[model samples]
Target: MLALLSLPDVALAQQKARTVDDLAKMYDVASCKQCHAKVYEEWEKSTHARSLIGTGRTIGGFQGMIRAGLMGAFTKSGVKDVGDVKVEHLAQCFKCHLPQISDATDEVARELVKAYLDADRATLGKVNVNCLVCHNTKAILHKWQDGEPEKGVVYGSKDGPHPDKYPAMKNSVVMKEAAMCGQCHGTGPNFEFPQPSQCATAYGSYLHAYIPAGGTETCQDCHMKKDGKGHLMPAYRDPDMAKRAVDVDVEARGYKFLLKAGDSIPTAVVTVKITNKAGHRIPDG
Candidate 1:
């Protein structure tokens, strides 16, 4: 079955017998404030809180797809009426972007994009690919939840800490695995990444002979960093996380004050180039 529970919510889900509806009920972003109130405050200021959900950053990538006439009729339902669709309809985007909300079918996804296009400041701007999309394990792409394996993600402690609200995660090996990042970072048509896009190929570098042998640094180690961002997976283009991962160097390049015809010859050509020396991949799924 398509995975419904995000990792954080999975921790809570263990305490109770969870159904799809139960998962939906418990996956409230508002509920995160119960324990992570301060982190929630930081998250509120961060772009992560608003990203795919149409709040902090522009969801123009997905939106641009629609404007470019990439949208087509759903093969399953044979529904082509784009005029009647709403912004809350896109399940494809919701599947990876908004894990909590249900009924995000292909038709619905089209509707959501359409709705976003037609929406004004009013209507609360239906939650587009909201907070749980990337951070929550539920939104991981091209993977299915294995029922037999102890389901859920745990950030702190091994053998799992007992949570009164939901499920308790026991083994955290999943957190350290590159597969964890591949859960969303890489994409395929259904299970493996089918397309040739950069988003789909993100996990390849981790699997190859380059980088480091047996590198255990998962995406979470760099982006999540146990810094209370939950699962926003911030990196690269991120305005905030980039600052924490960058350093600058300056050295004198044959500087000599020479007065040539009263023209200041004290300055020489100084070149500066920024490189992504530190930091790593972030899961976009």
Candidate 2:
């Protein structure tokens, strides 16, 4: 499934994070679990919760991209060895995998790629899209218009004082819209890096085909708000959504076939057709 934050266009920040632990200090979801336990538990089951170590495939892909794209001489990324890798080198994959990497030093990038290459799940899984990623860091779409996301503020549907570390809560303008998910759900190749790479095009498909075809549901409508999905935000991984997104039909005919020996042989022809009923492409990759 494409990450809900597959298009986290996090602005570069002054480097502070040097290790996964450092990042956890700012983005850990566990901290919010105290008050938002239900939502936090649901998020724990989501792909966003394990944005970097998703099913172990994310780690393998990161390892492969480093080997083939950075060191393979194909992209000329100026990274010929593992030690040569920097945050900039991993920008293509980290754009979606973990945009918070932008807040870390190059050393963190080197450590991450090495962890991926070494298949270190514990290390790779340490940092991920946490509560702040949505409710704080990425909550506002128009930063200039809405002002920057305040440090102690947790953006949600309505404004109020939070009970936890986040002292304040402000209503987010784009929280219910598709843009919140579509922002990281991918539009096209990430052209911001020297070596551009695309993770998912569902958002582009949603904008072009789904919207033009008069499809009214937003991504949040189907993924977040529907069927009590909440923070789970399932896609194809949810069996019900999979069944609803695709349909298959089968037909078969039995007939007699002519043989060269002037004898008739029984023959069977089977035809199968599959259709997509979802807003975006099925099995988006």
Candidate 3:
């Protein structure tokens, strides 16, 4: 016998379509499109889009791994006859390469490959660094689910969509901080691998050079702003940003050359320290 399930059935049937906000609440970046149209547009053109899409880089890295027998070692029956070992490592590759979908690890790689084949070859190359790579970021930690806001991210437009329902756009501190960049830029246990895993040293350079020196510069300050950084996040992508980051700051003072020290001229102490002030527990590789 079937009892009447009126209100509960109606309620269940009437569930509304999930908004980007709803998706964001569940850590799905598919929702970021609600307000980040400009940044997304730029990212679509840049290599940022290819962060997850299949690339020779992935093949090359994996092939190198295969040659090293990392995949072959953990197989069930035989070495050459090995099954896919640590396919999870592909996900790790996407942690930075396809950050938006990284949180949606449930089905990122297949979706990426599908998306890539559907689009132009040129489009596929620029997939990893996507639209919200830097702007929507609160911090640059490895885990998508755990980025902390070093400061709150502020927005310029009043009507722009945000996690907060209000239209006010002040106290958006997250956008101007170094920690936001450190999520992906820093080194740690997760990155201490034989292969290049962490960008911590790069992030460290930015922090120490700019933050401690009383330079109100963030990663974006030098790489993005100094030369029209634009949304592409060209610091790592474009040669221009690399050249721009390279600059000579001449701070000259007369050396005392103290003989009384009785040391090897103190080794010409040129102390340079880089910081990853951005907060995120990077993997302990």
Which of the numbered candidates is closest to the native, going by highest TM-score? 2
Error of 3 at 49 (Å): 2.2
In candidate 3, stretches whose alpha carbon ends up further than 4 angstroms from where it belongs are 1-38, 53-59, 66-70, 73-87, 100-129, 132-172, 188-200, 208-210, 213-215, 236-239, 247-285
Q: Model 2 segments beyond 4 Å from truth?
A: 1-15, 260-266
Error of 1 at 123 (Å): 6.2
Estimate, for each residue in 154-179, the C-alpha lDDT of model 2 and write its tens digit: 99899998887778989998988888
Against the true structure, candidate 3 reaches a TM-score of: 0.48
Please identify which of the two predictions, 1 or 3, would achieve the higher lDDT against the true structure.
1
Which order, best to worst by TM-score?
Answer: 2, 1, 3
TM-score of candidate 2 versus the correct structure, residues matched by position: 0.89
Give the per-residue Cα lDDT of candidate 3 at 200: 35
Error of 1 at 169 (Å): 5.1
Which 10 consecutive positions of candidate 2 have the poorest summed lDDT? 5-14
Alpha-carbon error at 12 in model 2, in Å?
Answer: 12
Q: Report the C-alpha lDDT of model 3 over 31-115, residue by residue, as the tens digit.
A: 4566777665665555455544334454455444444544355343123422322224444454555454434332333333333
